[model samples]
Target: MNFANTGQMEITTLENFYRDTASLIPEGINKEIGHFNVFKIEDVLARQNKKVMPYNRRAYYKISVISGKNKAEYADKVIDIEHNALLFATPKIPYNYVPQDDDQHGFFCIFTDEFLIQSKSGVVLDDLPLFQPGGYPIFQLSAEEVDDITFIFRKMYKELSSDYAYKYDLIRNYILELIHYGQKLQPATTLYPSHTASARVSSLFIELLERQFPIESPQQKLNLRTAKDYADRLAVHVNHLNKVLKENTGKTTTDIITGRIVQEAKILLKQTDWNISEIAYSLGFEQVAHFSNFFRKQTSFAPLAFRS
Candidate 1:
């Protein structure tokens, strides 16, 4: 019944994650860079004691190889896996893993952005297409691809427990390998190539908008709530930003902004028990009545009605 503190409706911190699953963090982790840990899917499930994974954002990044029937729900999308798939999760988006059957097998590793810093890998976590806000993070794998990924994960598991002085470095390479492999598996069309200034601006605008998300706590308010707000952040004139967005997405700047806000509103309404006033304030509405009017206009349903 005490689900709020259990991360059912808020951001789950790494410490809470370990506690919830009855898993132990490795002793003497290198806090200078960050933390890294890998686990067998079954090992984590066995310790879960049937506790459902919370549909909330996490404070860290995660890579998971899920085998078996499962469903993944994000704030904006849902993916159902009938057999095997690779999932990449970031702290910006909240997700819930629902296993449709009792049989589950795979591996997952949790890490922080600093774990593979630019100094080590010359790779920025956000710059990766798979981890990007608009990128496709899940991939259905072939049997051969699954075997290849499993092999790398097994190497990580072994390296993590080794006495080698540079084991962490080796693990970082393994993580990057997984990332690149996923990128290669992505459909050619899904990978956006910024060939022009307008396209680049449009892409940056979308990324900036998505980075504010999952509204993990009541006190966390949205900083960019209007077209002008985003325009200012992107150092572009409001009219220019609107023109770029309209040309690229077929929706005016305000339309796109409000559309995303409405999407988040729906997720909050259905996933959390927060009162309308709290939700309104978090979404940058000064009054619940205003939020109600906006929600009704966008969704044709009152917040309470939608929740029910």
Candidate 2:
């Protein structure tokens, strides 16, 4: 959870984010935001000895349009944002931003999902392609896009202090507009556009597989644990999924599925104290014996022995 130079930070509140960097917060702002707030950094270098933000999950969603140079690290990818860039941040993912020099300045807004979901628009934030974790959330904006985005953020800044009763409705519209803009540039037409059919199928298959993960409780069983199940969910034939997986990864669909299941099983065995039967049941095994045999075949060790 800790980065190399910077210690560690788990910022879940707006005040904690703004308190350390007073330059970012504008004056005359209502000192309290029940769930959301917008801040524009007129001078990014105002704070001396600025440290890099480490990868951490926060309880807020952030959309920032930065107009300078900076490097961002998200999960396993590193992105260099030159000129003006529109970046999206979500609570489900971890990310980091390292400012380049003194000239890094931009506008960023933070809000809880409740802020938008409770609005009259009834938008499902996570369901949007722009907000989805695996979808592209960062864009190198054209000058016109920058101007358009800037106008929205500026409107948000002005409306934050407005006395209008329906100002929030207008602000929500701005937020949605920003998202739609990003979506228009993002891979809304296709999640991954590869050259070969094998690559596309592989990428899509992996995405579909990942959508079913991070099993939360014993009461919740993994629904798609087989190649056929995944193929059905992805609207592809089982043979087609197997062929593409073999072509791209040099492994059959069943092999990939089994390997992933074994990895998940090992994690559960090592990280949780769930009994073998419960773990097996949650992993889509009807009986503990079947799961034990499968685990032993895959790992060359019994589940209990591996756990011990």
Candidate 1 lDDT by residue in tens digits, 1-308: 12134234666887788788888776546433677899999988899877257887787899999888898886668889888999999887778789999889999999888787833667888777787764558888889989999999999999887878778878889999988888888777656575679988998898889888768667779999999999999999999999988888899989988988998898788877899999999999999999999999998999999999
Error at 166, model 1, angstroms: 1.3
Candidate that would win on lDDT: 1
Question: Residue 207 of model 1: what lDDT?
Answer: 84
lDDT of each residue in 1-308, candidate 2, tens digit only: 11122112233345556555663443333332335678766543355346565455555788999887888876445899888899988865567677776576678888767667756677777766666654557899888989999999999989987887777767778888888788788753553456687787887887777666545457768899888898998789999999988988799999888876776677567656789998899889999999999999998999999999
Best candidate, TM-score: 1
State the RMSD for candidate 2: 8.6
lDDT of each: 0.84, 0.73
Candidate 2: Cα lDDT at 65:
92
Model 1 bad stretches (over 4 Å): 1-9, 30-32, 232-239, 270-273
What TM-score would each prediction reach against the true structure?
0.89, 0.62
lDDT of 1 at 161: 78
